[model samples]
Target: MSVRLQLTDIKKTYRAVTALNSVSLDMMGGKIIVLLGANGAGKSTLMRILAGLEDPDSGTIQFNNQTTDAKSIRRVSTLVFQKSVMFSLSVYGNLAYGLKIRGVPEGEISKRIAEALEAVRLSGFEKRRAKKLSGGEQQRVALARAFLLNSNVLLLDEPTANLDPNSAAIIEKAILAKKSSSRIIIMATHNLNQARRMADEIVHIHNGEIVEASAPEDFFENPKSEVTRKFINGELDF
Candidate 1:
């Protein structure tokens, strides 16, 4: 069965600054929702909340029509940050850690690790030290690790930002390959072209609020909000 997520009246503040203001969004499984925004527009903040890494000051989250808390959300969500973090271990070890803790059998862990690495174009790098690889390679390994979880919600914050074209392309392909009826993929990116290519729906955020949400064709060609139009045309200052 498909899953649904709803965030209602979300508000967050960091001391004197407001990060999110009365934000509400509904997402369903099997779709790619891409958030577009400038720096500090709350895209990362929202993703963090969804991933259960952080909590909104005030909000209600419903997963599959039932209210849930951060811990429950965390159980079903996987997040990949723009700056990937790696353990001081080999690629195989890093990928296998989560599976082992979940009580997956040794044979299945090996098979899944191999498949995940191959998906990220890192096949045969199992013996390499994760922390010693190039930045792009590390990010790919991070993506591979997330893939092994097969979480119901996949949250990506600029997953392909600042990488070589080949690495970025490979990551995008692997992400698309993982889309299924039982999963939801939400990504935040400033790369308009990448957003256009990967997004099933484009959501524009500004100053901690959602200004517009529409399909890629409508969002790029005919934005309704003046703020959205300016953003699309590169007139809004970050």
Candidate 2:
């Protein structure tokens, strides 16, 4: 089934700072939408809102045309952080935790765990300690954990930032492989090359608002906004 996520007039604030201002967007399944912006540009804030980790000060979210709340969104969305967060346990144990809580059959959990590990290219490391793995390995494990949930919406914040080239490439490949007609994948990144390579559509956000959104080709070659031009030319100071 195809899924559609719509955000309308979303606004968020943190004390004296406005994190998101009248931000609105629409996303559909089967495409990778890259949110391109510098640090402190509200990308993370918007992601958190989508993930149900934060409530917008003013906005409406519709899933498949039905108005929804944070609780409902949380059930169908998964957000992977920029940093790798792992439990102090074996990789298998970590991956099994969610399934266990959800009472998934033991056999089914094992099968899914294996498939998820293989997706991240860490199939045989299930017995290893998650925290003991290298940075790249840990991040892979994190991605695997998120994938295992099979959420309809996947939100990634700087997914490959600060990683070695190989790990980044592997993660990117895994992400692309996961795209399907029933899922919507949104990634936030500042890396122009990565965005250009992976994004079907690119949305530029600056100062807590969306500047423009377009296909990658037009986003780079024929930007309509001066802010986007500055961003493309490496002139935006954040």
> What are the lDDT figures for the candidates, one per model?
0.93, 0.93
Tens digits of per-residue lDDT for model 1, 22-103: 9999999999999999999999999999999888899899999999888999989999999999999999999998888899
lDDT of 2 by residue, 1-238 (tens): 7999999999999999999999989999999999999899999999999999989999999999999888999989988899989999999998988778778999999999999999999989989999999989998988898898888999999899899999999999999999997899999999999999999999999999999899999999999999999999999875
Candidate 1 TM-score, C-alpha based: 0.98
Off by over 4 Å in 2: none
| Candidate 2 similarity to native, TM-score | 0.98
lDDT, candidate 1, residue 235?
97
Error of 2 at 110 (Å): 0.8
| Candidate 1 structure lDDT | 0.93
Tell me how many residue pairs clash in candidate 2.
Answer: 0
Candidate 1 displacement at residue 58 in angstroms = 0.9
Query: What's the C-alpha lDDT at position 147 in model 1?
Result: 89
Cα error, residue 181 of model 2, in Å, equals: 1.2
